[model samples]
Target chain A: MKKQQSRPNILVVNDDGITAPGIKNLIEVVQEIGNVVVVAPDGPQSGMGHAITIGKPLRFDRVDLYPGVEMYKCSGTPVDCVKLAVNKIFKGKKPDLCVSGVNHGLNNSINVIYSGTMSAAVEGAIEGIPSIGFSLDDFSQEADFGHCKKFIKAISLQVLEHGLPPATLLNVNFPKGDNLKGIKICRQANAKWAEEFDERKDPYERPYYWLTGVFQNNDKGEDTDVWALENDFVSVVPVQFDLTAHHAIPVLNTWTFDV
Target chain B: MKKQQSRPNILVVNDDGITAPGIKNLIEVVQEIGNVVVVAPDGPQSGMGHAITIGKPLRFDRVDLYPGVEMYKCSGTPVDCVKLAVNKIFKGKKPDLCVSGVNHGLNNSINVIYSGTMSAAVEGAIEGIPSIGFSLDDFSQEADFGHCKKFIKAISLQVLEHGLPPATLLNVNFPKGDNLKGIKICRQANAKWAEEFDERKDPYERPYYWLTGVFQNNDKGEDTDVWALENDFVSVVPVQFDLTAHHAIPVLNTWTFDV
Candidate 1:
């Protein structure tokens, strides 16, 4: 008989703080596959893309939030939680996998650029761990995540079995509602937020501005994340952190810079 | 007679706070090209990648920092400065170009993923403005920037004349010495910071940690940004915010995920 392999060690993190129901549901699903460790932000960290706490001191303490799982609440951003887990908690022993979110809202298309949920997975990829970030299309305090449990387990198990490519992570977005189609491998849609500042007076009558934006999708490609999500399919865009635009190098080299 | 073209409006921003000498030198060089508007963070915001202010209200006010230049100091991240400039100052009219950071330190290779300097430029590109972020290999309060002035002007003028490719910006890094080679268009190096947290105690004897890391570059390709910078060439890596790893999708599609 073949020797049974040891269980994989999985690091769980999120942007929606430790108490959010989304992460709790994720923990329940993943714990069946491996030994899970939870290290997440203490407060809501929506849109805090790739941010690390540099100017301030960081604090993380062990918590009993989930049954039969080791968990900690971090007083920092989502990226900081990953850093802390890697450097302090794990003590330089890299985990078998790092998974972030089952985030409360959508992280589709251009939203990935501004997402703390996706940034945690990006950080994990940078750390040489097979990683994935999961998000739902709904934005509610009590968002329904029932449709995501089986899908999340399947994806996580596949990553554990197959492993991911270097410098890459999966940005997975699930469509809202229970009647879901299968997953679609897609690219990031060329989309953006058209920002408008609602200038208002504070209690002391000083003028302040609250940022509000409308999601604008201009890319009409059928193989985009936005299109897949709109058609009720789970969209998975493989994300890499290397920002180099390789196609533009030849054009840039032709320009003269002699002064 | 030829019709006279109006002066281009340029937006200048940085992560090194409003009074940093790096930005001051940049302003002096770019002012000769067009009408200048500066909106930058009031404090240092290094390693703050693509972060936006959503929890608290933001405050910004006009300041007289440079002669013949309009300036504003914002109480937010580098990305916030760009958004405020676009919505509040420019009033939805896109500037001719946006330039961020003649930075005090280098944003080569993996540093670009965590850099507030490059994040500002990325924010600009997302807003459909041609953008460039410049950095020096040296990290000092009074680093010599005389050698960068002419080069900065040349690059900025080129971007203004011929705008960048769709959804792209430049990550330009200069070598630390006066004996400089010409510019090299390169790709982002495959590199990362090996982090080590220094555990220490506070005044009350509670333990806290400070993040410190050594940059590890294993990529040996001469066409990479790290190689170009190490060889004393000004490296320009055209960067895009779309994190999609298009090459990895085919492999992922073969994996089984049926639950």
Candidate 2:
């Protein structure tokens, strides 16, 4: 008989609140591999980025969600969920793997910076845990995650086996549905949301704005995450938390800082 | 007579709310260089990061905070303030330069990811504007910003003269006090907050948590932001919006994708 293997402890989280179907699918997939514990936002926190609630305290409580799968909901951003999980529940013993999302929207290219899903994963990486954030190109409550599960399981297992580079985490995004073209390791595309704020006056005659935008892809490279998703392929981009543009340092150094 | 160049249009913003002393100091510095338009949050959004307000409407209104400065206050995060400034105030005519903060606390090293000030600068860079986020090592309401003004004016002029590299912004932090040892070009230090949730109870006995932490600096490199601040030098790190760990892409591509 092979030596008895130990099950890894997996911490699951998402930005789309604790009850969202995307996270439910992720929970089911990871439960098959390890002992799962989920600490997610109590309400939708889409586009929260790396925000942490500073001026206010968080409301965290236990919830009876899926049977045999322990879960808790925190009234905070996705990053706060991970921090609470790591500090309160795990008690400094970090989970073997921290997986965020299977989000109901795309978080490729420049969207990563404004994505609560990826931010949760980035926080995990900062906390020294091997982490992956998964998202689908679709942004609907009923968006089916059927096709993405097997691939997520495979990729997560690989990460669990061969740990990621230090200070790095995986941002894995899937296209809509089962017409698979396999996985392609990619870089974040040079694209951004060309935002347009819809201005409307309230009943009291005060001006208010609603944020809306169009996804603009200017980078025509085939090796970008945007390209992979557009071509019906799974894109795995390795994201780093160190925002320092190291190459630009020498160029900036040349500038005289005299007043 | 010298060539009469049109005055640069400068957009000023901060996460420390519209009336903060830090932002007032920043506004004073930029008004000396260009035509200033201020759009900042109505309340302190210190750790809001790259978050954008999606689930709610924003209240954007003009305020007479300072005479001769066109200032507006938004009921949103710092990133939202930039978007509103671009969409409504600037009306697609992007500003010559965007300056965020003279933040009450330092946003060096790992704090960059969790900083609204830096995120605003990052947002400006994404919008093809030369941006800079300034911070001080002090965290007091009445922190002395007198010594920081001359240096800020000089740096802003230099950036206006020589535009930064594409997709890049500056994360500039000053040491507290009058004895600044000039500027130092640096990289973000490898440091992080060793966070511990301060648990407490409300009136009904339900537990709540207050996020608090001590910064832990593991990187000993002299060319880092932490080092520059420690040496009483103003640190300027060229920051990028591209979150891709491009170096790790090839290594990930080598992994087989078959389940």
Lowest lDDT sum, 10 consecutive residues, model 2 chain B, at B250-259
lDDT of 1 by residue, B1-259 (tens): 9998888899999999999998999899889889999999999998899989887878888999777789999998999999999999998889999999899999999889789999999999999999999999878997999988888999998998889988899999999888888888999999998887777899999888788889999999999999998898899999998889999999988987875
Q: Can you give the lDDT of residue B19 in candidate 2?
A: 92
Against the true structure, candidate 1 reaches a TM-score of: 0.98
Give, for candidate 1 chain A, the lowest lDDT window spanning 10 residues.
A52-61
Q: Estimate each model's TM-score.
A: 0.98, 0.99
DockQ of each: 0.80, 0.88
lDDT of 1 by residue, A87-190 (tens): 88788899999999999889999889789999999999999999999999887878999999889998999999999988899999999898888888899999
In model 2, the number of clashes is: 0
Segments in model 2 whose C-alpha atoms lie over 4 Å from true places: none
Residue B108, candidate 1: Cα error in Å is 0.6
- Which candidate should be chosen as best, given lDDT against the real structure? 2
